[model samples]
Target: MAPLHSKSHTSLGSRKSSIFNFIQQPPQPDVYYVGVDVGTGSARACIIDTNGIILGLSERPITRHELKANFITQNSTEIWNAICYCVKNCIRESGVDPEDVFGIGFDATCSLVAINEKTDEPMAVGPDFTDHKENIILWMDHRSVDETIEINSSGDKSLKYVGGQMSIEMELPKMKWLKHNMPGGINSCKFYDLADFLTHKATGSEARSYCSTVCKQGLVPPGVDGSTTGWSKEFLLSLDLEELVEDDFRRLGGIPDKNGTFLSAGDIVGKLTAKSAEELGLSTECIVGSGVIDAYAGWIGTVAGKVDNPTVSNKLDSKNNGTILTSCGRLAAVAGTSTCHIAMTKEPCFVQGVWGPYKDVMAKDYWLAEGGQSCTGALLAHVLAIHPASNELSHLAEASNLSKFDYLNLILENLVVDNKSRSVVSLAKHMFFYGDFHGNRSPIADPKMRASIIGQSMDSSVNDLAIQYFGACEFIAQQTRQIVEEMEKGGHEIDCIFMSGGQCRNGLLMRLLADCTGLPIVIPRYIDAAVVFGSAILGAVAAEEAVQEHIHKKGKSRRSSILETQRSQTSLNKVGSGVQLGDGQHSPYTAPTATASTTNMATLAYASTQTGSHHQFPTMTPMTEETDYFNQPPQKKPFSDEDDSEDEQTLSFGSKSNVQKGLSQKLGNLSLKPLTKTTDTSPGAKLWKVMEKMTGPGKVILPSDENHPDRKLLNAKYKIFLEQCYKQQEYRDLVDGVEAENIKG
Candidate 1:
């Protein structure tokens, strides 16, 4: 591996060629895998062997120019040029013939790119569009504050899916801002997110990833009732940017597809046309994959599956505990310039201040909710680089022969050790850092907020550097805790924390996370290269090849597969018996491995519509006659002929301490708390019914304070969430219900 710090500031050197050692000849000989990742400053390329090893790696810096205080922009032509350079470098380094390369995949930051497909020219974004081709909007850009407020105020149903609010960082706000401010550019342009643009440019395909549209843009996936739609025509018309709803909504991304299902990347998307081939210095046969957002690629690479540890020998005993335990349950913070916390759920959840429940966005059949801060490590660097003590620290680091980050960490470590009474983890207690410096991305998608530092002193020495460093780390962890807390309130119960990205390597930061969240942190063995491997897997899958199989060791099968092999001879353990899935709902047909009885047949309520309908009951081995409900109606008749799926949230309560234990210790105390009492029957049932009446179809769930403890706590917490977390019309309605009840009484 190369040293942590690059010797020179320019580009990666000839070591790129040595990476070819990992390249494997494909079974079909013509098949290959490509992985592309776009970071805050550049786009990188990697070629991986079929076994998921890096064969070749290359990179080219992307051009990002700042126009104003918070405005960041990039040139599409420049980005494409960088991509071409990296691809050519990869082919040259690996010495792999382009024709032998079969599939390719890509992922980039969720930036916005605009172009005129007919003229194939860029449209202006601001007064500084001199490059004409510099029409791309960087993810870090935050110039549409008012636009975000307007969209949030409209209380669009699509907004609820994105945690009940909209932000300027997302594409719709930017699009609306563009149309209202620059009518000419809006008229002349066809809009595409940065990832969508790269894929379209490479393959001449317009398909968008559900990952991008559902997460960042206001594209709602098909719900349980099976209705699908994009930005509302009426809403856009009301906003006076109705032209976007024209052309059947071609400008923004159309119906989005799952990641890795589109045209494969390695096989010639369209043989590199002569013009493009000449510029890229590659054979016409080079293939390109449908690209993805950078963070999603990280999700594809690191946490998709196949993570194993020999030291972790114990298996979870409870049926339901195993699924959440075995799965990577930690918040994955893709920390670099910014930090994003990605959490997954078996069912789709609409958190009031979180990002998604985006369908099939990353892992197929799973929903994802992304919470994050706009800045973390990058903000720290930017702040420290300008500090007066930085010059002194740099001089000291040069003398000590250490990188600046290492130097700062060492100092903080010494201080923590000397004090003995305090730990670096507790630094945020004395000092707090507001997330608004780059703006908050989650728990509040408010961009108008600015970063603030509390408990600063006039000390301009090395200790100042240590304090700032410790403070920054603490601030990030607190922000992360806040996000996790919000997710829990929205009904997501996460246990461990999984970390990736370069920043995850920092021991201080990891310990800080552990201290704040009080959860064990799992850092995957392959950290930096996870995204590359993930994209390669996506490419492999798109090419009609099996990639999930590559996640395990050569002779080892995945947990599901292993269970299948043994199930015929011995009774297999069913998921969710001793373990809780929130509400009291359990799959009766599930077999238990421990001191529990197996239900005769499966009847699972509260399961996601997508997976529950088609999932086959897990068969326990040693076939015995048991009643099968596969084709039978449910045992219980309808209590009320009403669909209460929205109110069907179950509360699975694992002790806070249980989350910190090892597998065996953790599995000992699993308890199920089913808050299954229907609000329709409770005293608060009438109040909830009244509140339901106040809400219209396609409206959001709101809080009301009319009833006793249960309803009052719900409304108060929800009111605080809306007033302090994220505001929407639904929140106002909830508050209005509280007032209306007080007067009536």
Candidate 2:
């Protein structure tokens, strides 16, 4: 291993041919991976083959305890149960043998899960009216707004990682809120980000993922006082929130808890304990991989194919000079209710209001920076729903047997003139909008700043609504443009856009984003609904790590060091009755040795000593280099007439992918292929020679009126109007309040 700190800085110096730490060779055909993704509203599971294909998928709605839209919470126990239900269903539906499954991975929203270690139960962070077991602090909750203001006032250096300002939505401010508001909740065991909690629940591993800790929890950055990694007690003390480390860093992170140690995204945490195997309906042998935040998972899943080779090749280039991909420079926009603008660069670039420069949080070795709109799809729906044209448009959609969004797109198509440069941009130019109704998450970390709409008309016609929708799309695109500019200013060479999440479905939004940003948008087909697959990637990686550990021991299959580490303190006598997933058998928590269900003096002494004065922080493995393909060009896969499959000729909604029941056709054929359109089939189809002039798959309409004077005027005038919004007295008060709070305290 190349030492701990070397892992943090991935892009430096010339080196020899070495295996990329994160890369995994294709496993045996029998091996499979299970991935679980717990988003804000749902828990989804996917069973995948070694070839990066989804074989089966299942999902269940996750319940949230809401005091309002801003105070969202969830039950830890319930989330786990939901995951179990989904995992079992996906595995059963996929018809894969339980013994074939070798690994599993997880990704969850960056919510906080407060639990009582003494009882192994969740504790409350909210009012008493509801169940205390609903102990999660949802990522969207804003109850800690005041606390965030207070922390930002401290002006700590840690704030730089979070864009020089902390949002109420982040963990530290929420930690402050919990400490002050719910005093009883402070006497805790472990406070886990939802993702890490899932890993702990599954494998009894006490390690946290680098994704959640560095990105969400404001962990002390690399090289702080020669520490390898963990919370910064100094920074925590600076905020007067020292309770996070009351237990020798146990609550924040101590040796006592199995999850207290931190693991980078691909590390193996441990094997599934018998209890977790029973709940998940998988074998106890299933290796549990370290988890990640949902958005980061999406980033990995979307860009991995572009950055790394997915095929099984044993060629010279595959080792020393594999495809060096430039996928890192491409920004991934996970657009749904909110849109996260995620970018990666070779080194740290801190842009105020944009959170990160987090080292290797997502892409390996590269620093990740994030910016976002507090609202996107949500804001669009909010304004449109109130318009009078909404009902009429809905009725038209229903009458046409199409969805409202589809109907709206059709209406937009009619509004455009053939061969005119005036696409949706022409109609929306008259109206300008700034979306921060839910508070800006990035490029301006101002939660107090509300949204502004400068253009509206008395006309409530359907066309008006459609035009407004177009304008919102344009405005959101403009916001994205501004974020890109700030990132460029901060030294990230971002040009191409990688889109993911639900918003990628909107063809119009995709086109406008490309035009506004003057960048090509690469929408990986699987990236849109990819959180679960990303988790599976992590699982495969963990299994790879375990394989290496075994190899180092000269091919011993004895329990992995990580697994032995977790159960090392527990005596063999404590083996409780456990359910076995395979062949419907029964067993104990561990089959390591004989069982009598008794504890000895040595066990107690060991546990205490590990957590007491003599305790030592877990040593991290030296950082391994991430796959070196992100800066390489995508291999040009030329299209050929022979590529058309006869089977695809009649693919439709009613068609069943599994009607043929081929293994490749399983789970509705979730493909990782790049989405492209046939250039000859468009409006320029007849003139094939002339159509070669077109390069992009999407019609950007930039050629039409390339230098329209109106576009310049709109851009300049809108810039001034935006300046005025921030310069207004109300905006100034919001800024002043942030300043006053920090200065006074």
Candidate 3:
């Protein structure tokens, strides 16, 4: 909530300056929101205000087990415990009273997690079957490749809703693989999408978000006709998954919740499930929220309600017919180990070669169009690690108390000074990297595709590494550019880009993106915890369930209450000749002729005044120039016939009026201010060293070996942070030199 400003009363001079300043403050101090994100690697939580200010954040990595190639799984026990720990740590760091935390929300990857509710045990969805008790089908796992093709061959009616084909990465295929591979598994257990599982874990409710089911599971959302809703038993039967259809789609999930519909953020996700709370060292009072898919959360954070004070035209108000338009083909690229290019549309339109036109997956009213490569940030890391210059960079980074990345950035910056013609984006000229390291996720959707590199050399110098790394970035941007272009051809229009997650933080990456895409990228100044922020906002919304009714009653035409306060200089004086301050006549003087005065207060008034040409006041005024500030006509944009024609039409819409096009669904707001500043010493740097020492010399992932680059070079921040737990050590200190204390929950 922002401070209300009265547009009617504000003077022209002060209004512009005051509006930006006022919106910075939250409307209420006690209100708090939390967002939690579970990526492939870790679960993180962020505490924020209505104004998107992050108060606190924490993260913990969940344990994962990889039984064989293309078979990735995680223990539910580990993931749930990690979630609890992160939530508690966020609460403690925010220093907000539990009562102040109004709501919470969750977002996770579209991974598959299975549990046996009846037996209270885990069912294995693995190859060797050793870990039958704790099994999950990770999104990246390609074990269901055959099962996916089999399902796709059915050409079921539901296939029309998921852009005409299902893939191994989606839920249905994974579920089928689980049922077929482990015969007793489906009979004994319950299946949950990771997002829904987090929500169920939090709220003790089995409600599934529309975003999850439609995009990943191919659940046919209730068409405008409503009769078409629910899973197609006939379709499942065709795929030999009749058991799942016979279960009334129970195993596939049916209870649906809309995106941004809150459950609980810091409130009880059913009293922390007792046993779970104990493991996290938290009380049952610590509330949890229903979770969302990670990319969906990123979408939410990027395109939640519009900012009150926009520097340029409030695109939110101007675009797509002036209603709060659901994003029209907005591309939300969640760049990390891989990049997910997510888009949404009003009606179902299947584009060949893209992942989805999944209904109600990203937003309730619109369908989602997701596309991405198998590798982005991850490929960059691989290229850097194999470079010969990596060891020299690592040694410098260690001695200088900086991460190798930061140290490399410094070197790049120095190089730019000498060769002014070359930009960071241009460094990729002689190098190219393939994104299909794992496989092409979208456009091609080919799991068999392998990585291809062009223009490699025997020389792996610092310059070579820099050029190669920069090329990897350009490749990602080009990939996104390609995705957006393909989306437009498929009846969706992508106007602007909203990026988040790991890669968005890099200046080089962002600049390259803006240049390549030719669209203004609006990066929110929120915490990088988009997942948690989105969840927290939803949780806040859920806690205030009555708000819907209240808003309905208030009608949809509610303008944000803009409270404007006037602060003008008022002087009192005696107008008599030779009058002194002690004169009895105290006449309040109102300066009629606005002559430019020496006072700073008067200077502001003169500056806002315009000349006949309608140009803004020059930065410096010559003494000879007449200070005709007084009697200067009010400076306003000259009214034109075009303006009058546009102004005649009322643009008011309902509170939930669809307005801006190309906005992401409400995911989460991340508090990323801390990451923006350069630090003398980074926790990531220290952790790498410690891990290096722990592993000892001759290790492939060493800090000092340039030829044998450490695995941390993969992204701006290594994915290892998602799992690496830091223990308190004297050597580990904050960049500010503060002793590393125990991370508070």
Candidate 4:
């Protein structure tokens, strides 16, 4: 609720000044930028200076409507209001003069916002079509699963960019569902990805971001997939969504005859509108940058922090030695209600089940891939809520003034002490959890997958709850390993992970993640605010652009004024070798070289001229068998009595002595040691200078020793984890076969 972490250059001697006093104060010479992030549950705003040091941060919860199962919706109006509230509060808290706020950037969940074109009012997109208030289809909503299946069946070339499968969570599937279900069809409605909607709200520009369009709406960039315009008209026509192709795809952020302006992350959209400025308590001169999905913002916020490890830092710098830069090697895991694994590469890597190899999403000239888990923090919460000892654990945690997670971690440590075990991990030696309660987003890409738990007991003690919590954390870590492995198999050379989220606060999770993945986990300085901070970085870039524009214009005017004076003086008097000014110094003005605006304009012109034929879809390439692992049938294993009786052998919590014996047996010869330490060998140099300036250094947690005994245990457990995943598929196959036979009979 309070400012997460603030570093103020100005003295706080007058901190108690009223809001009016702060507004009336003269603008600071130093410029500030504001970043607004709209997550699933809340809207947050933070004000940062050029150095990317946060001065103030505030958040406000928005209303969510779950009208039915898997039908989550929100009101755009309420979300905007919450954003305005957070911005105003952030400014007031920071005591920053509104006029000094030169730019603002926004990032939100990749949800769909529908607006009526004629009235320019929020249009309903939900179970109750009459209720116009709920205009946003929340990103997590799965009401469009059937539509997703239908679209994926089209086998469009555009689907290749999204890992050969279109997710139901993406905007296109939701739009299809709305078209089929909504009264009057969606012809009169305009759809904006939530991030684009936020930018439009701020600056009144209908322009979209490449991050949103290319990643979610299946808009292939000009150079990729042999498309001229980003939109694939033939693909849309094949899917029977002709309304989107009409009006030059205007409703879907496409321009009629010309290529629409789809700005990259750092590009400016426009200046803030007067209405938006007043609402947000900022100046109208403030520029609005193109927005990105929240997770992409996290990638921007991290990946650039100075790594303390020399080995990793060297890889971040060298280009010739099989080493990739930070943008290519580092993966940003933005975890909150869910966790998104974002990585960028020099070329597109078509990883199956991952969301993208999207171009110009987070950074220019880089391809971005997004793999995610649909539920993580939410999964942990559900696990705790369903446990019988949850209330008791909560009460104990409250009394101790600790969070439930922290308290559980402490309980696990105590268990380790009492059992004389090497580490708390021993307590969960036999426990295993399959964490796909909301479904798997990556590697498997199956929405129907459910969660499973092994090694359960009738005892509902707090100790059992602690073990359950540990298993959940382990599941998150193991799933992360699985996602990383899939990405690597697809040709991504991931080095270390840059994680930013609420989950970073949980040390046990961090440790388990490092141990499970065998990669160092870099924690950003502002762990909880990294995504918002990344948005602030975009705002900073926009502000820098505005300043450059001002300088260019001022320089041009000064040169004009000086030239006129020089000509007048030369005509009046006889000069030396040349017309000399009074001070005998040369003019300081030089013509402004190609700025970002001109370069962008040139790019647009090129794209407009290169409008390739839309009638033909590009030749589709089949994914290799090894890379398309998700499509392959689960490997069959011979049934055995041991496999059938494995559940019966699970340790029961009813007896402490038996539990200890089971843990020891499962752990085998495992012995715990402190995490492995690595030393810096190369000269420390920053790789991403701009990002490093914005994000600063963070703590690094190295993985356990590769040769440790625990590695063997964890490796074996991971095998079991994979087995459980295949076991789920086997169950589904058996049931499906039964249904088919029944129909025949």
Candidate 5:
């Protein structure tokens, strides 16, 4: 069906950019979503449009179940058959139109997954792997290190926004080490949160994701519109683990959707189940929605200021006084293969070791926090696969067709052009890189911190693996300038740095994170599989479904053609420069910039009221699924765990001023309370506390040369040798001579 302006696939890895293809038309009161995500390895899928663009994309990879230690696992029937093989190969490479898609969503990696509830089957999480299809558990499996040190020695005020400590990576110390080592492996069990098990595997509706139970199961706490969100039951009986609050919490999800919906992340949590529309070929009248926690869909892929339209993220909201954030607080990081960061505020500040201020999970009434880094792109492909010039730079990057990280960014741009150090992070002035091999997920939330490397040189050239890949991008931008100086000492006034996963295309780790955290990072315009277009903007704000109405040439609807495309605006060009997809596979699609560019408005006034940020794309016809307008009226699968558990399942939530606020004001004990000083702080936290205690130790702020005096003496000889190798016993004595990852019980 597509073939009007045909070609669309953009991705960016090899930079083939272009757009303007609306799959054989599509523009009227537009609608089209699809998202997907999955993560700890792969399973993407994009297919966007309502002006957040994208159109068609696909990804597949997946395979993990690696056992032995930091054990990982999977197989929710192989991640729902790799999300039905990347959504039928991204709707056959996005010729789109399975009834113009409408919705779908999903985001994963909070990884726990177990199920049964009378024969829904799959439970076994692990144990010499007996396979009820491994039944997940993954999110970096740290086998509940002594039940995360007995739930962080039972302090449990929800362990202070998870920064005060509780590491075996969330979900109640991996369900208390899976009920003390699988004691009868949970019978009619039910645990989910691999993005609410792909939205209860396409809506039989097990209902969770208030962004996967408020950020990785610290168990709900963020919804503040007149309170009452449940589960604390005395912090689950102070960790004796109250069978996860039996019936009421319905296996960790305080049950709401038996056709109710409003759980969040842009609503609409049901539909699609005609056996997930014949295993995702699509169309049981689509609309699944509700799912998150793949770094909150990479913080809904950087939603920019004053709701600068990623299809108007529901005017962000504080009841449209509109502050889904823009002037300050924008962090996001999203680095990929490990590296999180996030940050959003307006209320709860928290900090401690840095996890969250939580609530409204990713985007809404705000307060998210996050901070991570359990290995950046798996420690940059294990520092370029334990380099010995990585097999002759992978056969000279496949004989120069490029891509061994784009031929290691063209061997650090031919050893930094005319040379006088204009960047390869200033030729690793004495290599330091301490990438935390697979630990340190924030401030010092230490999961047994390991990994370091100080000045090595027996010259194993390829320019010493590009100065050890620019010393792992200047020690991950000095561990993001020490996690933005512990989130500006836990108050977060954080001015600039939005970045977005997959190492925001390195341009030397974005200029060594703007010269080691001197802020100014930006990079938005939703490019490449942007966490499946931020899970298809949570399935176009969870599609309203009624076949997203159209009919009336005058009967008027498509919500008045989306209020006449939001009171129209026009201009065109640049949407057609991105082709290359007959299918040699590589199109995560890019082009969504309908107006952003603002930098020097009087030295960083960054203004974006979005004036004529380009618009008007109305043209029509060509939407297919064997059209007769998709031959309506046959949807029967509106959720059926055996016919909606024989109907009448009683599920009502909120209002009449519903003010319960869970058992005794649910916050988990509460303590973390710093961040509120505001007299204009966070220029990357006063440039990372004046480069950590008054720039004396190996001084930095080295870029933006004051006429390069050998680039300010090689940035003061590696800023006094990385401030005399910042301590805590040299990376905790190299993580006690490391040996962790062998996790599952």
Candidate 6:
């Protein structure tokens, strides 16, 4: 019952400095941005200046109702109110004039929100359709499994973009579920992705973000799915959800003659409505930028972060014609309730069981592949909650003035020291956990997959709970490794992971992830608030565009026009002159010379090979290795080998075949080496300037030494991690086989 001790006890607190400390000193009269992020449990808002330093932040928790198992719903009205409260509080905290905040951006979960088109009031989507407040179908809700399966059975080509089938969580399936279950169907209602809904609430604009529609609503970007229109109308009709396609998909943000004006992330939606402005304690002059799904916001906030490590930065910085191409090697893993693994590629890489290969979702002219685990943080919480010793652990943690995770981590570290183990990885060497409790979202995209525990006992003690927690953390790391390998197979050569959200604070999870995957993890400066900062970045981009428009309309010099329009706004200070304006005129703002057209030839060649390919990749054969590990029982000292010399060994789990070798080789070839070119005075160049100034660097967690004994331990555990996945399938097959025989008899 003694207070546990570890070096990591103060690590999280020390790293989590106040955002105010990083704010620009002696606040200038510059335009500000309010970034609002509506997460699963809370609505958070932050105020950031032109330099992208967060000045103030506030958060308010929203209520969610789990009416039934896997039937989660929330009140849209409550969410909006929480957002408004957070925004107002953040503004008050920052002491910035409301008039000075020129732009606002919102990002939320990819949940579905329903409202009556006529009344503009919430409409219920839950079991009791009368209570209109419970209108939102949470992104994690799995009530539409049957509908999802039905839609997938149509064999629609649109399904290909969503990893061969639609998820139960997407809008279409939820819509279908609502259509079948709701009393009057969906004719009286309009649906919005949560992010789009927030923008609509703020600006009264029906504009949808490409980030929301392309990623969730199955709107394949134009030209990718061979459709002139973004929507697949034929696919909709096949599913008997033609109401969505009616009026040019009016309910889903499609305009009549104009089709739908799906703006890319950061595109200006409109100025805030008077009502919204008053409610949020802001001015109507605040332009609303198009919103992105929360994970994509994490991508925006983290991928462009400056790398402080020269060796890593030099390796990642492959610039062709002054364009920064470091994003290709960086995968943004936005880990919170669930973890979304997003990687950008020059061309669409169709990895089976991974969502996307969708264009223009997060960045311009780039394809994004999204893989995820449906539950990570939630899974860890579940593990703790269900265990018998959880209460004792909690009491001890509280007594020591530490969080449950910190307490558990301290216990783990102490165990390593006391047992003289190699590292924390060896703590759970006897116990392996497969955390697919909520379902697997990537590689093997099965929703029915259940969790497995290889070596659990009836030991109801706090020490047992800590080891279980360690195993759960190991599960998260191993799954990440699997997801990365799957992405690599699909043609992405990810060398580092840029992480955001609450999980970034978990030093144990971060270290495990790096060691498990053998990839350096870059932690953003804002940590928990990175997604909101990304939303703030959107606001900055929108503000820049809005300023340019004002200048062009006024027909005055750019600087004078901006100053007059913004009242006290100064010219962009970081990059001066040689920047392209919105109307093809040169501006005082400077940016990189890399134009969108200045792409690497090697990248182009790689895309050429995958031009018409579906989810096909080169056949990868298994690695040739001794089967001794699988043949023997689990070892207590997996790291204790006579060959444990400090010789560097690459800790790879899967095949070392030609395909694996080719992935690394192809990635190297695709490195965008610098090419000298004339300065690009294009409109896109100016946007790049905004991005460079706004995106800042953060603390970096390098992968554990490759020669460390823990590397071998993790590599071995990862194999057990993968084997358990197949073991679950084998168990399922056994049960299914007996059921089939019984039914036949």
Q: Per-model C-alpha lDDT, please?
A: 0.51, 0.58, 0.49, 0.68, 0.54, 0.68
Output the TM-score of candidate 2: 0.72
Choose 1 or 6, whichever is better by TM-score: 6
Per-residue C-alpha lDDT of model 3 across residues 120-186, encoded as one tens digit per residue: 4677777766677557788878788788888888877666656567877788888887778786657
Once fitted onto the true fold, the runs of candidate 4 whose alpha carbons sit more than 4 angstroms away are 1-28, 255-259, 309-311, 314-325, 548-689
Model 1, span 110-163: residue lDDT tens: 888878757867876764755576687777688888888898899767776777
Taking all chains together, the TM-score of candidate 1 against the true structure is 0.64
Which of 2 and 5 is the better model by TM-score? Answer: 2
TM-score of candidate 6 on Cα atoms, chains taken together: 0.78
Kindly give the stretch of ten consecutive residues in candidate 5 with the minimal lDDT sum.
648-657
Ranking by TM-score: 6, 4, 2, 3, 1, 5
Is 5 or 6 the stronger prediction by lDDT?
A: 6
TM-score for each model: 0.64, 0.72, 0.66, 0.77, 0.32, 0.78
Instruction: Please say which candidate is ahead in TM-score: 2 or 4.
Output: 4
Tens-digit per-residue lDDT, 1-745, candidate 6: 0001111112333323422113222212345788998887678788875556566677767788897898999999999888888888777666576766768889998999999999989999977788889999998788998898899899977788888888887888999999888998888989999999999999888889888888888887777767767787888888888899898888888942286778877888998886888788876778888899988888888887665454566566654233434467689998776788988887789898899888877556677889999888778778888999988876776666544665676676566656866556776799989989977888899878989898998898987998998888889989999999989988999988988755554567777787889887776655566788889878877777555544345424354454466555432111101111233321100111100000111111111121221111222222112211011111121221112111101111111111011121011111121111225544334334555566655445567578877788889888888899988888998999999999999
Name the better of 3 and 6 by TM-score: 6
lDDT of 6: 0.68
lDDT of 4 by residue, 183-228 (tens): 9898889999999999988888889998999999999888776888
Candidate 3 residue runs with Cα over 4 Å from true position: 1-19, 26-29, 128-132, 183-185, 224-229, 254-290, 305-313, 320-326, 399-435, 546-745
**Residue 332 local lDDT, model 6:** 92
User: In model 4, where is the ten-residue run with the lowest total lDDT?
Assistant: 588-597
- Worst 10-residue lDDT window for candidate 2 reads 593-602
